[model samples]
Target: MADRSLESEQSWKALDGEQMSALLRGSLNDYGAPPAASAEASERFRLQLEQSDQDPMDAFVEAVAGLTDAVERLAEIAAKDPLAAAASIDPSAADYAEIESLPKPIRMTVRTWLGRLLVRSRLYDEALPVIAEVDATESIDPASSLFYRGACYHALLMKQEALTDLRTLLENEDDCPIRFSRLAKLMVADIKPLKEDSLDEISRLMTDVTRRLDLGRSDEKVEGQEQKIIDKLTKLIDKLEEQQQQQQQQQQGGGSSGGDPKNGQESPMQDSQIAGGSGDGNVKKKNLGDDDGWGNLPPAERKEALQKISRDLPTHYRDAIEAYFRKRATDG
Candidate 1:
């Protein structure tokens, strides 16, 4: 009898030709795949093996992709309605309920592939439900399921969950695929320092907004996310301005107020910095950068623009102006 314990310990990374052959045949049998389909898949697997000495994980992924294609085709054939084919292409569609009729092993493989497909398509929200169905430890390719699910989580900004799966993938360094481990490591690093509603979070949200727009999605959800970014930016700017005002106040209180006969050195505390204008009309404009509403400009022009915003605009009006300019830039 074969060593059941040894077979259980066998990692995909260590599988040789004979072992892989047996695995393919066993999986096919377990799924009760048709004889003709089995023959074709076997031939394709043999050709894939011969074409290049691919990593076992790579080979496993290709095999699963093939299985998904076969399953989709089978679903198409079994489907009475012509729309079933279209539904198969969309993960959100209900026609994939046919996959529930498949045997356990086949269903897991199909779901894993669907999860990966949705992630690659940048459909992180749609991918999560499908990916959550597979337990990584029990998956045929643990590394693949773990990495892709973690990736989907990371893309959706689920930091802790992403870190959980990614860190788990890295824990089994010897058994895990090198490519996946490396990517997981990078994603973990990216997610580590992110704090809620901070500028970094807003930047990530901006990136997500851009990604959605690129995908031709301008739905209410996308617009809502955009509004969140604007709100965050407004809060951040308000906090910064508060800090700057406090610093100016501190500097003013420290200086000799009545004996200011200094020649070209402007007063550190200017009435112009205060919230409403004094009759003097001397307002100072803060500097701007790439992140601000103003694009890069000559120092003089930047100063001019900042003066326009700071002098005439209220804080909320400034936010609205920034949002309008941002939308214009995006449209262009």
Candidate 2:
């Protein structure tokens, strides 16, 4: 009885007569053989052809033939012309579908590539779903995904969601915040009214991240440790991103910028004069501590000055700027 049942199961899974016929037809098409006239002939032909054919693994080899080429080309575009690649919809969308169709380990490579791509294109929404799917199926560096996901949540003003992700990142990512916590702050500000505790937690994380990364420790050990700390800080930011924006808006009337806090609007000359200002007098009076002076400078001059400040400022502060730009570069 057991033997009969096993045979029955085997027959059930064996390709139906039609499926066998199709394989036989395909084999004939490939080998230029005459068509079979009966089901038995077709099945016999298919089995014989399958047994005599080139190694079955050859299909896998052929399937991956273009992989290296595609990867190299995509990497070049991502590195040399990220914006150009990101500007097109095909590369990003097709990449997801392609990865989903691939075998297990192959999909990991695709996921990582898509991760970097999503970041470069600022397609946060598109990236998140793929990340979630990858997480469901495989193990990856949650920190990398966390950074992008937090940024997306913050940008969309989903404070609670951002906070949850950021907090996890903070705990698990080492010193990631030493490079990407500003997004947390932005989201923190938006969520403060709903979860004041999250803001406090983020502030505490930021403070910790700042102190540890202080004084430009470029030694290898310090650098690696700093990274671990920064990762933790990123999680904190994500945790705070979900705080209530509308409530905060009602509570503070949208925050106070010395200029037009409402629109964040500043004239170009105002930007220039601020950047070109002497370290004293009106600039000193207007500057929000030293950061305001350099930070408020015109965008062009601010570039070099920011690099210099990165050396002089607290570790957390420099990381905050880094995170802001990292988020921008990745999310576009």
True-structure RMSD, every candidate? 11.5, 20.9
| lDDT (tens digit, per residue) of candidate 2 on 1-332 | 33454343221122333453454344333433344333344555445446666322222222232333444444555567654434322445555443344444334434544555665465554555544444411222334456666666654445677776666555532334455555655556555564433333334445434443563334665456446545644554333332333344455643443345457664344444436544455433443464544323355644654575356756756656577568657866
Candidate 1 residue-wise lDDT, 1-332, digit = tens: 85566544433343345555556656676666776776677666767777888744445545644655556573444245323333453556555665565555455555676677667778776677777777664455667788899999898789999998888777666767688878888999999999986766776787788888987899998989988877777676556555555665677776744444476434455555645534587758866555763433445654454455456655544554466457757978
How close to the true structure is residue 103 of candidate 2, measured as C-alpha lDDT?
Answer: 47
Q: Candidate 2, TM-score vs. the true structure? A: 0.30
Q: Candidate 2: where are CA atoms >4 Å away?
A: 1-70, 80-97, 103-132, 136-140, 173-177, 180-332
Error at 220, model 1, angstroms: 1.8
Give every collision pair in model 1.
none
Best by lDDT: 1
- Highest TM-score model number: 1
Off by over 4 Å in 1: 1-70, 74-94, 256-332
